[model samples]
Target: MWFERPPGVPDWSEAESYLRRADPALGAVIDRVGPCTLAPRRDYFVVLCKAIFTQQISTAVATTLFGRFRDLFPNRRPTPARVIEVLGRADPAVLRGCGLSRQKTSYLADLAQHLADGRIPTRRLAGMDDEAVIEALVGVRGIGRWTAEMFLIFTLNRPDVFPVGDLGVVDGLRDVFNLPARPTPAEALALGERWRPYRSIATWYLWRRGSVPVAAPAVPVPDAVAGAPPCARRRRPRPAAAPGAAISPARPRAQK
Candidate 1:
């Protein structure tokens, strides 16, 4: 279940109204998707870790690997101490076997050390503004602007964040606006200005629009024993032909 919006959160509708008054294109999209609220997620550490895991990977694969990592330490989410405890003595190959790249493993370990040494407190970031949060997060190795922006949107649930560097957002703009070519990140930032404070919600919708739904796995049938009769396979029925393709009862059938 999703967490409810905290009390006194800014009204998205009002933001939408402001954007609509600013640009017709943004207003049109807002009209279509309607009001959107921030989708709350787990705390900073988990979100950052997951984001690191998901870098340059498909969502399905990332989800599977993240699940496996969680199973390794049941009930407790990955914390700084837990990361150090599990990874300090564990072989690098073992972490790599969990689908983490060597660079990511090193980066995560560095992050854990920073957290453990009181260099950065996860809780202290909450009260800071977006820029400040980004500044602090990117101070750690391997954490970039895109990762920090994700932390802002997913973990902090900040009202305004537009990751102009995101490829999906750029593609979304091209597809939605019917542009001949994809815009550069700079161009995307300029275009995103129209969305303003509700850019986070707009970005969420853009991602949702471009994401392909994952198909469920197919169930396997049991193999037949040595003496057992083979089970019949079931097939889906085809749809009936339309009027033009239908055969008339009055017409004589042609022999094959």
Candidate 2:
């Protein structure tokens, strides 16, 4: 059962109709998965920070690290100014202590700097088209095309993004379409042509195919290193992937 509109998200019935009409292979997935249920998040920097932190880490680990990270902020939430201030006081080692890698630490610092300097104005994103938004976001350190695509889908709720580089998406397509081998990014893009204008809906279904459900990050992470937000709670352990399942690696390539 699909809603005409799901709270903050745009109506998805059009996208649903298009995807089913465009490809029977995807139609099967829709039949199994039902409807798109993406909800937008308001905190641009937090979500981007989470995306960077999540690079190459399991969701469980990422959840833990994010909890530790939000502790550094005054309210368990990070704004550009506060992030910059915290980074200044806490050296690289301190950040790494929160489960961040050297590269990710540098990436966060760079992002904070960009946001503070207004080089990557989060407010301007609403007026820009998808490719322009990607261009803007990718200019930041450690943020790639795949990351940009994710922002478009999860943050802005753009409908047509197809993250061809995502392993989950690739594996989903491979299994769903019965391809002889995992399709290359180019092949994935070609295969996705039919789902145009609503590819994001299709992507939502693909991700669901082999994913473990976790509570949304909207619940702030708990156990602050410095008396951060009290709203954070530890996420429960998730079951491991089944044998021969498609493994989602950290940071999909930003190409094709």
The numbered model that scores best in lDDT is 2
In candidate 1, which residue pairs get closer than 3 Å at backbone N, Cα or C atoms, i.e. clash? none
Query: What lDDT tens digits, residue by residue, belong to model 2 across residues 1-256?
Result: 3324456666677887777677665665566555577777778899999988887777789889889999987779888888878877887777887888777777898998988888888888877899999998888889988888889988889888998888888766655554445666766776677678888888887776553322222211122311322112223334434533433433653322
Candidate achieving the largest TM-score: 2
**How far does residue 196 in candidate 2 sit from its true spot (Å)?**
0.7
- What candidate 1 gets wrong by more than 4 Å, as runs, is 1-11, 91-93, 209-256
Q: What is the C-alpha lDDT of each candidate?
A: 0.62, 0.71
Shift in Å, residue 107, candidate 1: 1.2
TM-scores, one per candidate = 0.70, 0.78
Residue 222 lDDT, candidate 1, scale 0-100: 20
Query: How would you encode candidate 1's per-residue C-alpha lDDT over 3-66 as one tens digit per residue?
Result: 3445665456666677667655445545544455555664667777776677666667878888
Among residues 3 or more apart in sequence or in different chains, the pairs in candidate 2 whose N, CA or C atoms overlap within 3 Å are: 56-250, 221-232
